[model samples]
Target: MTVKEIREKSNAELLNDIETLKAELFNLRFQQATGQLTNPARMREIKKSIARIKTVMTERELSNQD
Candidate 1:
């Protein structure tokens, strides 16, 4: 999801999504290890999505602190 959409989601939803994305990432890594992964670029996209989720979570935490 885009950062804007990620930001709009409630904290609970974001947390849940993070878990789901992490599970997908784990599967992607397994596919890569087995050389069964198609579209290698998808790995990068998934990594970026994880980063975006983390970045948004950090931003929310900083905002809460303020």
Candidate 2:
């Protein structure tokens, strides 16, 4: 997901997305550990998306405090 799309989501939606991403990440890791992962690139993409969502969430939190 793009940062623009993430930025447009409400805080609750972002939180939900984060939870979903975390679960997916965990599953990906498990697959990798078993040497059954078909696409290693997906792991990187998910991590970056999670980071983007987190960065946007932090920005919103900081803005609210100002």
List of clashing residue pairs for candidate 1? none
Supply candidate 1's per-residue lDDT for 7.
Answer: 86
lDDT of 2 at 46: 89
Question: Tens digit of lDDT per residue, candidate 1, span 1-66?
Answer: 799999899889988988888898889899999999887887788789889988998998999998
Candidate 1: regions farther than 4 A off: none
Q: Which 10-residue window of candidate 2 scores lowest in summed lDDT?
A: 6-15
Off by over 4 Å in 2: none
lDDT for residue 11 in candidate 1, whole number 0-100 = 81
